[model samples]
Target: MTQTVPRASATATPADALAAGIGFLRREQDRAGWWKGELATNVTMDAEDLLLRHFLGILTPQAAEESARWIRSQQRADGTWATFPGGPADLSTTVEAFVALRLAGDPADAPWLTPSAEFIRDQGGIEAARVFTRIWLALVGQWSWDDLPNLPPELVFLPSWFPLNVYDFACWARQTIVPLTVVSTLRPVRPLPFDVAELRTGKRPPKTRTPWTWDGMFQNLDTALHAYAKLPFNPIRKAALKQAAEWILARQEADGSWGGIQPPWVYSILALHLLGYPLDHPAVKAGIAGLDGFTIREETDQGWLRRLEACQSPVWDTALAMTALLDAGVSAGDEMLVRATDWLLGEEIRVPGDWTVRRPSLAPGGFAFEFANDGYPDTDDTAEVVLALRRMGKPDHLRIRGAVDRSVAWLEGMQSRDGGWGAFDADNTQVLTTKLSFCDFGAVIDPPSADVTAHVVEMLAAEGKTGTRECRRGVQWLLDHQEDDGSWFGRWGANYVYGTGAVVPALTAAGIPRSSPRVRRAVRWLAEHQNADGGWGEDLRSYRDREWAGRGDSTPSQTAWALLALLAAGERESEVVTRGVEWLCARQRPDGGWDEDKHTGTGFPGDFYLSYHLYRVVFPLSALGRYVRGGS
Candidate 1:
């Protein structure tokens, strides 16, 4: 006997919702045949942009006000800015936003400023913010440079085999750290026009003793680095600075940004400037211009607002859109799909990048998340890109086959020794790197994740390599890492629901039976966690607190994620899945899309979150299409 599922009355039928979603995607497609949604993060992007302009001495009053308008709009009623929607107040984000507002000429004693300043003091003031936040304040003379940790440029000269070498850090952290070593060594301080004393409590937080621990050891190391910074004559330091500058310059992308992300982009400009590169220098000029490209400007009810994307996701979004379209019954031979396939083929990376530091002999062939991050083609994007290409039944078979072959070889070579795939470099799991006092923010190392590994396993299985040793090992790895409650942790998405969703389909594709204990447990977990409204959602807090796992208000993308797993697990006729389908149909907008203000993507797990605007449409369309087709 099948379990009964309660039905909710929906304005649109599943078929109607699918058609509307497909049409919405078609209308949103670019002339070049791709789709990209707005990648929204917290106010730090806007706050940091203002500070960068002030440091470069190019901040226009209009620009400041525009950015400030956007920043001010993000503040919560408590006068604090959380990293994500409905999350707790973040001291660092609140501090950064308050200072940026002050820089925009918001009077310190003003009604809005008073609440923010009070909140900062209550949270232990500027002294309690993260290292990166303090580093930003130090740049502007608001915080003493001496109080911060020192990162020597000499660390760049460490051999690859040595512990804590530059390559040991994640690609994102590596990019930011190299230039920061120079900035810390030069220690430039451009004083702000006004003081932020109101945001400080004037009393230092008490320190705890832990002489035998990793934190204690790294703290001692930082003390030595500080002493080294005070030296008058150090011949090796001069050579290290030269080498570090060259390292930064060599890695600059074609668009003049480093790694196509904000941290590195901003720090590289500052480091180069201190190393005597004039503002007019081509590298510096292009760097500034590239940032303007990342800037999103729009007219709102309040006023014209400006904000920045920490990174872009054109290739990632385009690949996902293609897969969604195919799942929604769009013909593979459609001109729209052919154009997308062609564009993806053109974007493939065929040359060496930083990943080669470890796999030096491995040939390069993969896709990156952004438009021009050739230096870092990730496994996640490459896996999905291959899956999309394999689905297209167009006339460009030979070309697509060659690219797919290269990507398979590249991905296999990039797998970690533990038989799993990380987004970037393989075996980049140095625990000591995260223990460093200077590395006290977001993930600093790329480690194999269940979600990424699941995609690779699914792609390989789709290619008929299910019996290969690599595929078998990846399957075992996923089995070995499931949570006690039957879910997997999603390193790149929101908590357990995302992880379980990605894994269930991949396991079934790789030949795991729906009746397998692991699959059934995951299915039960999803069904048990269903929201009262018949949809699914998981909070970003699940990354930090287990109590929140698979719990939150319903979201379109997350609900679709759950449905995809159930549909793949042979649950097409189950009441639980029927309810999920009905929930999506009832929520469909007239234009065929859904409204989702909450972030469904993860950047740094607990520290950062992302809102992929396209997710609300693409995912639901795929789910509803599969449902209407009776799980295909």
Candidate 2:
């Protein structure tokens, strides 16, 4: 059921709400000059943290109990856990959560355990779980390693020019696959305290049909690889293993994570340990400490519970916060704004990373999503940081001018042949990587996305380069990709609302008339989709099902996204804009922040999602600020 706030008269006006928001943001800023909110995801992060600890023989009783408390609280009444709130129960997530509870000392006959086991059986038991889940089971000796797809360490030897080379995979996938290759080859197993036979059905899983296509070919390749694994040894395998270990070690960030992400961080530790690195080794120890930093322990109404973030977002959050405060009319010279701008300038990445493979000669100038992911500075963060700096208007500061120039050049150099931009690399849209049987889970490749492209276009326009060849090409890409209903797909956020919100502003700023057919059509779509209570939202399901596009219970962040696009298209006087502004003002919390539980941020579209806790504040503040400013 869609949630609706009563349409009572809003007690706050746009100006009043904007002031409250600005004050709220100022209070939240770090003394060091950035603002970072919690990045929340599913229970898999907590579950996986426990599993890693268990494998490392460091699963303390107190830690297991605390994490289990959080995991159990997330279970649905139907005795299953969903990847996102109100989403369908996921077979893999439920399987992992159940096993984590068992490790936490829950008895097999416990009330919670029995129903979850039953749900697992009804959902095809362990056989139906995702490849990653099965791999986890295999690590704990609950499943056979032979049934899982093989990822040979020799993949590290493939040159950049070769198909399916490590670079062909998305940066996140590449970081994970490299370390995973080492683990798969070692095939280490740790014994579980108890068997989970009750969770399994009595019948063997049926073989899936693989037609004569890319998937079929990869399936055949996997079979051949398994046959090869059965050999006593291959002379080249030792060299491949050594090379893979070196590659993993070389990429460990200063914070002791590979790419500042959970999957690669844990897998890299396991890979190194299996290859004979002890727990106390500097690299291994640092990786463990890094994960400890990602842990979040809080006192809930039920009790003290612990959860883990899949990744951190200090750089991304700070950039958006700066933009929001600027939109709210904070002076650039204000102490807080000046501090944030200086901090962002210091965080600028000057070293080349994996992106250099495609743009070997382009000078490095970008920003990473985390505190220290120097190996993978993303274009999305770089774009947003540039925009915020430009908005701050420090034209006389040589440092700021040089940073913006280098970033704009870097962004232009990273453009793909399609005239669009992916988050990490240029031309990283290889379909074969996603087709690999080993990649049956989340996205394995980073393709150009509408949201990322629109941000770049808007950034370029703000830099007064709207007519540059690169900028024009990006605008054309957005025009070509517009959906039939006038919305665009948001690969990095919730469906069409995020995409349309981003594109309309970029188009208008790039000198496309507000009266253009495309702009008017988008305005019509936003007006048509407004909820009865006067807001907007789109479910994560929109990625997989068209019916859910631009339709869901209203959320502050999503509603703000819609309002931004409408206002950009000269809808400041429209009733749609009025109601959206009112919805934001009516819902502002006592502290000026907004309460949002829905996962509007996208990780892998339908397969994975994120709830950026700051989205609720930053987006609405930006929209309300512009609304009060007569849409600028």
The candidate that wins on TM-score is 2
Query: What's the TM-score of every candidate structure?
Result: 0.98, 0.98
User: What's the count of clashing pairs in each model shown?
Assistant: 0, 0
Tens-place lDDT per residue, model 1, 565-598, is 9998999999999889988888888888888878
Over 309-419, each residue of candidate 2 has an lDDT whose tens digit, in order, gives 998899999999998888888888888988998888889899989999999999999899998898899989999999999877563378888888999999999999999
Among residues 3 or more apart in sequence or in different chains, the pairs in candidate 1 whose N, CA or C atoms overlap within 3 Å are: none
lDDT against true structure, model 1? 0.90
Per-residue error at 69 for model 2, in Å?
0.2
Error of model 1, residue 290, in angstroms: 0.6
The count of backbone overlaps in candidate 1 is 0
TM-score of 2: 0.98
What C-alpha RMSD separates each model from the true structure?
A: 2.6, 1.4
